[model samples]
Target chain A: MSLVEALRVSVTALATHKLRSLLTVLGIVIGISSVVSLMSIGQGSQERVLSRITAMGTNLLYVRPGASSEGRVRGAQGGAASLTLEDATALADPVNVPSVAAVAPQVQTFAQVVAAGQNVNTQIIGVTPDYQYVRNSPVADGDFISDRDVEARSMVVVLGATVADNLFQGGSPLGESVKINNRQFRVVGVLKRMGGTGFGLQDDVVLAPITTVQSRIMAQRTAQGGRTVSSINVQLAKGAKTEQATGEIAAILRQRHRLTGSDDFTITSQEETIAAQKEVTGTFTTFLGIIAGISLLVAGIGIMNIMLVSVAERTREIGIRKAVGAKRRDILMQFLMEATVLSLFGGGVGLLGGWGVSRFISGRTFSGQVLYTVVPPHILILAVAVAVATGLFFGIYPAARAARLNPIAALRYE
Target chain B: MITFSNVVKVYKMGSIEVPVLRGVSCTISKGEMVAIMGPSGSGKSTLMNIMGCLDQPTSGTYQLEGQEITRLKDDDLAGIRNKKIGFVFQTFNLLPWASALGNVELPLIYGGGVQRRRRALEALERVGVAHRARHRPSEISGGEQQRVAIARALVNNPSLILADEPTGNLDSRSSEEIVAIFRGLNREEGITIVLVTHERSIAENARRILHFRDGLFEGEEVMA
Candidate 1:
């Protein structure tokens, strides 16, 4: 029989048992749908990470003290106290590092902040006056710390938007005094509302001049002779390669610390770490997609089982067609086509279902940022291809069995 | 043209052989109308199966239009059955799910083409049941069902027609109409026909009659 005729017959056969055909392909639908949805979620999360990296500034780098090799293993936060305010000042000099732009040294510590009878625990950041330009945070009301404040060690502070809201109830605290670590400081400014990078929240901290934080509050918390700062944030000049700046920064830090064997600091580009993390998430998503495809395999078996049953049920029909001069391949084609069509139908429905559900889930928001689900077009094509291949793989045995039935015996079958 | 030489058919039943045909030899020329009459278990149906290439003989030399078909492959035999022979079964074996026109189009479908429906309608018209072409087999009477089967058999324009009790399930009135149609096809279309029936009255409708007993031909009589 021609393919058109065979397909027509298969459609008719399936139409006769509509419920059975639908149930037979249900496993495929669920499998494909899960594969699509999980991949979408994975892609969307990867985008979230990428956006976070770019949002912080693609040309930015951070230098932190490496963990003290004296005994224990620690991350950059617990590293050696080799990074200092002098290293930040040295990098800022254009003669030493031409790629250097504005550099901001931070001495970060968590503290309980109180203002207007309201109390909130927040990070207390000690920064130089260049922090406004280097970190992309500027004052929204009043003024940030002046050069005179850091020069004379004035007890003045700037509150991030969230810290200002919690401690002052969204009112202006320009001329008020807030206590950090039980020490009174004058509020000079409130920073604008800013989003956090993947590292930490930007709008939940208090800022003060470097001299005041180091000499007075958090003075006991300072590690290694009280001269160490936590980290140095470096902003690259326009059109400067990060690779060139990284080498120059490392050279200057090693010279300043007088280390001949190994430097006690590590300079890392935020983009590099973000790229590595994105690769890991991509691999994890691919693994999940494969695991979800196991259901399609089970669905293939379902198709085979149903095809066998159909072959037995239509034994006499096979006999009649054979007696009318149908070759064995004709019978085989009829059954295989039926299975392929069934699976393709299931795949089409699954793609639509997965797309709809993903869109719905992505439309919701948790805190502020919108959670996203992305379904690329190629995923749809892959899902359908897998479905068709599954049908063909599972269809072979049943089609062969039907094609090999003896016409005389099959016709005799009631 | 057809010839059967020392034909034998033995079915194996797990170490035991059930012989259904025993050394039967016969010949019927082209355009001849022959009836095979035998009681149940007398090899009448087996003979029809062998003649239509549905089953192979155990030890025999059979030739249909000089093809030496006794040893043909299954697919080759299917081709011969498709192009050279038509079959009408005792049960009026029309596909109950299809309309009469659909039933008639089956052979042409297997034959492959776009002209199947048109040719099937023509065959139905030839069988005098074109008025019931759109009705399913279950919706029509047994006689019309049988006529649809006959149309299906003739749709391929085969050289031979083998009817196994085509009138067995019909009433006397319907049986008369079917027998008349068969005689007319033989006389006017010059189509060779071999019919198997237990009823002697049905056998008398043929031009020649052969009697079978105990898996062997007992006698033959020439009819007008």
Candidate 2:
């Protein structure tokens, strides 16, 4: 029989029993939709992480005070000490390491800010004049801290956009005074609103000089220094070798701390931080995909069950066709076509359903600007191919049964 | 023309071997309207199945139109059945889901022609049911359904028309109408016909009759 005629027959059969056909195809629909939606969410999350990481300067590096004890015990012998301001001074002295640009020593603490009876909890960061350049922090209102501010141990601050909004009610906060735990500090600048970086809201912060925050605010003490800094930000000189600059900085910090074998500090580049984040997100998405795959397997089994039923119901029809001159191959083709059409229709509906679900979830979870990434063309094609393949795989036994039927007995069947 | 020499058909049920046709030999010439009459379990249906290419005798040399059909493979036999034989069944056997036209068109679907719709319509017209082409089998009366079945048989233009109790389910008037249609096809179109029936009145219309008993032909008769 011609393929067109075969297709027409299959469609007619399905149309005759609309409810049964739909129920049979529902398995395929669920399988395809689960796979598509899960993959879309995975892709969307990955893109979100990538864009956030890229927004932080590609060349930026962070040097922490202690080594990453990812696999080490808490009481291990190589555990490092807290970093200090003296180490930052040594790294910033370009005479010893010409390949190094600006170095900003940082100290962080959570504090409550109060202005005109309005209060909000915010992160306080202590840094130097070049912190903006190295960290790619853009100030929207007033200027950032100056060299004189650090030299004089000034109690002035720069508020991130979120902090400024919370404290000043959308009014300019620069040159105004805000109390941090009842200690008054003048606002020198207001940072631009940087949206969430997937870690948290980047705009909810206050910045001050390292010396001012150390001596006047946190007063966190180190064993050998006036005060301690949590981390140090470093920028490499243009066209300078990164390995050489790292080595110089490490050697300088080791000398300043008088350490041997195990160093008292850790140095990380932006690449390392981005890689770590990607590893976490990749693992999370992989776990989700595997869970979704189980649903697809169940759907495949459903297709098999329905196809077998169809073959049984059409046993006599198959025999009649054979008796009227249809080849075994022709019988096989007809049954297989029926199965494939069911699955393909199901997959088509599933694709649309998955897309709609993704859109709904994205809208509910994030700003409407957030969109779930669509499954690529290749993935959609793979889904359709899998659906068709499921039909062929499950339709085989029934087709064989039909072909093997005895024409005389089948005709006599009541 | 069909020739069957020393044909035997045996059925196996567990340890027992039930022979349906025991060494039957027969020759039927072109344009002959033959009837095979038999008591129940006399192997008449078995003979009809072998003749229609729906079954093969256990041991036989059966030739149809110069081809040794007993030796042919299943697919080759099916091809011969498509080209040379048309079947009218006792039950009318029209697909329940199909319209009258669709049922007639089924044979042509497997026959693979360019104008299946036109041929199917012409066949329905030939059976005198062209007006009910769109009516499904369930919607039509038993007589009309048999006419539709006959249209399906005639659509492929097979040389031999095999009717297995074609009028068994119809009223007397409808049965007379069916027998008249068969006689017209055989006499006017020179089509060969073989009918199986238990009714003596139906058998009387055939030009030749073969009577069967206990899996063998017991007698033969020719009518004027």
Candidate 3:
């Protein structure tokens, strides 16, 4: 028989038992829809993370103290107070690090702040004026900390968007005095909300001048009487290679720290951080894909089960066809086509359903964040292909059994 | 034309051989209406199955239209069945899900033809069931269902039509009508017809009747 005729026969057979066919197809539909939606969610989250990282500026690098690992044991990241303000000064000079554009040294400590009766514990970061451009943070209102603020050790502060909202309740806190660690500081600026990143929400910090934070809020001094800073954010010059710049910065820090065997600091570029984050999200996507694959597998077994039952139930019909001169291949193709048609129909419906689900739930706020789902065309194609393959793989045994049936015995079957 | 020599069908039920057709030899020429009459356990059904190519004989030299059929492959036998033999069952084995015309088209489907619908309608017309062509077997009467089965058997224009108790499930009126259709087909189209029935009246309608007893042919009679 021709393929078209075979397909028609299968469709007719399935149509006769609509409920049975639908139930069988339901398993495949659920399996395929879940796979598509879950994969899209995974891809969407990964894209979101990568885009956020790229938005932070690709030419940026972070220089922080302490190696991730010590000689025999692992140490907390950025725990050692090895980076100092002098290191930032050395990096800013073109003579010490040629690819370096500007350096913003920061010292961070958590402190309780009070403003008019509202009290909130928030991260206090002491940063130089170059931090606004280096970290891609710009004040949304009022003026940012000026260079004179750092030189005079002025007790002026800038609040992040979240901090400002919580402390002043949507009211402008500009020129208002807030106490940080019981030290009075004037709120000079409010930073724009930059959303969340791998480091948590950027809109929940407090910024002040580096000198003021070192002397008044928290003090950590090295043996040489130099002020210690937590990390140094370095912006590389445009057109400078990130790999070469990272090597240059690591070499400079090693020379300044005077360690021969290994540097007591870590230099991380934006590309490396993005790659590491990608690995994490990639693993999460793969894990979800595996779970989806298991459902598809179960659906495939359901297909096999239904096909076997169909073959057995139609033994007499098979006998009639065989008696009318159907070849074994004809019988096999007819039954196999039935299974494939079921899954193909289910896959088509499931693709649409999954797309609908993705659209419906996409941009839905969960815990104050909008979740996204992205379904690529290749994933759709792969999903349909997998559905068809599942049908074929599971249909073979039942079709073979039907094809091998003895005509006389099948005719005599009740 | 059909020929069988020393045809023996031994069905082994797990190491115990139950012989059905033992050393039975027969010849059926072109354009003959023959009946094989036997009671239950007399192996008439088994003989019909072998002649229909639905089962192979244990030891035999069977020839159909001068081709060596006993040694032919399963697929080759199926090809022969498609092109040269048609079967009508006792229960009027029309697909309940299919319309009368669709049932008639089944044989031509396996026979590979582009004019399936036209030929199937023609076959249904020949059996006087063309008006019921669109009706499923379940929606039609027993006589009409049997006629549809006959149309299915005749659609491929086979050299032989083998009927196993074709009217066993029909009333006397329907049985007579089915037998008359067979008679008309044999006389008008000169097609070979072989039927298995235990009813003497049905057997007598054929031009010749072969009596089977205990897996062997006992006697034969030619009618006027």
The TM-score obtained by model 2 is: 0.91
Q: Can you tell me the CAPRI class of model 2?
A: medium
Report the C-alpha displacement of residue B89, candidate 3, in angstroms. 0.7
Q: Model 2 over residues A1-414: C-alpha lDDT tens digits?
A: 878888988898889878889998888888888877887787677777777766654465677877435455544422334677877888889987787888877888898888877999989888889888777787898989889999998989999898888888988887899998788999989987887533534588899987888887787677665578888888888887767777888888887778886876777777777788889878867886777778777877787777777767766676667767777767777777888898889888888887777767763445534544646666678777877787777777776777777778777676
lDDT of each: 0.85, 0.82, 0.90
Recovery fraction of native interface contacts for candidate 2 = 0.62
Q: By DockQ, is 1 or 2 better?
A: 1
Predictions' DockQ, in order: 0.69, 0.68, 0.82
TM-score of each: 0.88, 0.91, 0.94
Query: TM-score of B chain for each model?
Result: 0.98, 0.98, 0.98
Error of 3 at A105 (Å): 2.1
Error in Å for residue A406 of model 3: 0.6
**Candidate 2 structure quality by residue, lDDT tens digits, B11-31:** 999999999989999899999
Predicted complex 2: DockQ: 0.68
Full ranking by lDDT: 3, 1, 2
Please estimate how well model 1 matches the true structure, expressed as its whole-model Cα lDDT: 0.85
Candidate 1 deviant stretches above 4 angstroms: A69-77, A93-95, A98-104, A127-179, A183-203, A206-216, A220-226, A235-245, A363-371
